[model samples]
Target: MMFSATFTSLCLAAVAVALPAEKRAAPTVTDILNYALTLEHLENAFYAEGINNFTQQSFIDAGLPGFAAGRFSEIAQHEATHVQFLTGALGEDATQACDYNFPVTDAKSFAQVSYLLENVGTSAYSGAAQYLSGGTLTAAAAILAVEARHSAWVNSAVLKANPWNGAFDTPLDLNQIYTLATSIITSCPSSNPALPVKAFPALTFGTDMTAGQATTVSFNGSDASSANGMYVGFISGMNTTIVPVQNGQVTIPDGLMGVVYAVATSSDSMTSDNVTLAGPAFLSFDFKSDALLL
Candidate 1:
């Protein structure tokens, strides 16, 4: 009788241990807002570098803005002010200095730089707003508007478009911005990737666009031959065909939104999980294949 009782207790304890721990609720607006500030700082640094380069050019250059030097300084100052504003509401804990190292290896043109900053700033602010409330939302909106201004000016400067009314006049949604921002953050050397293998934490996945909404999707691989094994599509829509362009580029026939899927496997592999993409918002995936194998 004693032995049987002990066994029953042991089994009960084991079952308790095996059960999964309950997950905590997602973070609030305050948390998301504060976190997004860190990313802003990263952007500020990138623009500062570009602006510095712009001002240093001897005489006048085609792409350099009229207020290149002054504008960079002003933008940096605004970013600083934005940081100060956020820190006041959030405290010292809010504006944590990141170990930033943007991933874009090479950036030649002014337009490319502007596209990176405007698209990202717009997206980060939008995605972060979902988490905020009352005053924070208003503050976020204010910052978002300024970011839009930065994006606008940068776009005009780079593309030689009219500053007041550029081609991309409308603001990008959080989801769209998140995709662009995270890509730049991860690929650019100026932005930091917390985990070498991890995507940006502030990322928001693309939405599932309904019919009539034209969306363009593209992909580039590390190597030319690798393109053959790649597949890209949305979660529910017809898995559109991906056309190979040149060595690394692959274009998909789908609009921007929903959970996009990309799978790449080489000749030496024959498995679904070989190369997979996963993240908080499914922004970009990490690969696990023979080549990736250590």
Candidate 2:
């Protein structure tokens, strides 16, 4: 009779669990870094190819500024240096190298060449600045500035206007990079033409919390600006089923008492999440803060 009641309760609980809207998992920091590195490699290769294929004489004879050759060389070398620094930092064994994807093969047509290289380069650097750290941050800033210059030069040559559409200029920072990276991963994962970013990576954690502490796992989310849509839940197949403490949130069940637990969340479209849930029935984890991407 007791077993029958318990089985019925479990069935009801399963039905309840299936009722809410699910969240797509969030990507881990490691995932962000990997994508950033891959993009840097692609940009490096593109610049290298551009340098080899474009000569100063071609632009000068085409009635463009004589300095265009030097600018191209400078940007190419800068991109190469960035690739070297990132690869060294990530280590050869850890980093995955990728091939170049240039949109155009010919540079003889100045407007087309300018549009292809400068704007694309600017977008890549600006988009990636946030995911970088330490020396990588400095490198990204330097590259971004140069890319901006390249964009300005090209825009003036092509559209007869300032490259920045606005009269104002905005500084790109790590947070902006995070924003752009999340945006790119969400919207145009395949549009890079050079680097293909997979779904944003997810993170898992081994957490430590005081008894009764509350925590929240968060990410940029699929929408990027808000944290509303993620499907967050705790592992409940074991003896103690965690209860929902709030919307799309769960907590260490009161019955868990002094035990530690393993918790996980799987996004339908993104990376999976897993973490250690340690507690005094007071333990908690903030998924966004605690997780590191694999």
Number of the top-ranking candidate, with TM-score as the measure:
1
* CA shift of 44, model 2, Å: 2.1
- Top candidate by lDDT: 1
Candidate 1, 45-117: lDDT as tens digits: 6766655555535214553445555665677788778777776776644645444334322233443444445
RMSD of each: 17.8, 20.2
State the TM-score for model 2. Answer: 0.43
TM-score of each: 0.52, 0.43
Error of 2 at 84 (Å): 0.8
Off by over 4 Å in 2: 1-24, 93-96, 101-105, 108-114, 124-139, 157-161, 167-294
lDDT of 2 by residue, 1-294 (tens): 011112211111111111111122443345445445654555566667766777777666666665677777776787677667666655633344433223343454433434334444454555455555787567667766776676676545533333442332322222222222332121223323222232222212213222244434323222212323343333221233433334423343332221122222234232122321111110111111122110
Cα error, residue 235 of model 1, in Å, equals 14
Worst 10 residues of 2 by lDDT: 11-20
Q: Worst 10-residue stretch by lDDT in candidate 1?
A: 11-20
Relative to the true structure, candidate 1 has a C-alpha RMSD (angstroms) of 17.8
Q: Count clashing residue pairs in model 1.
A: 22
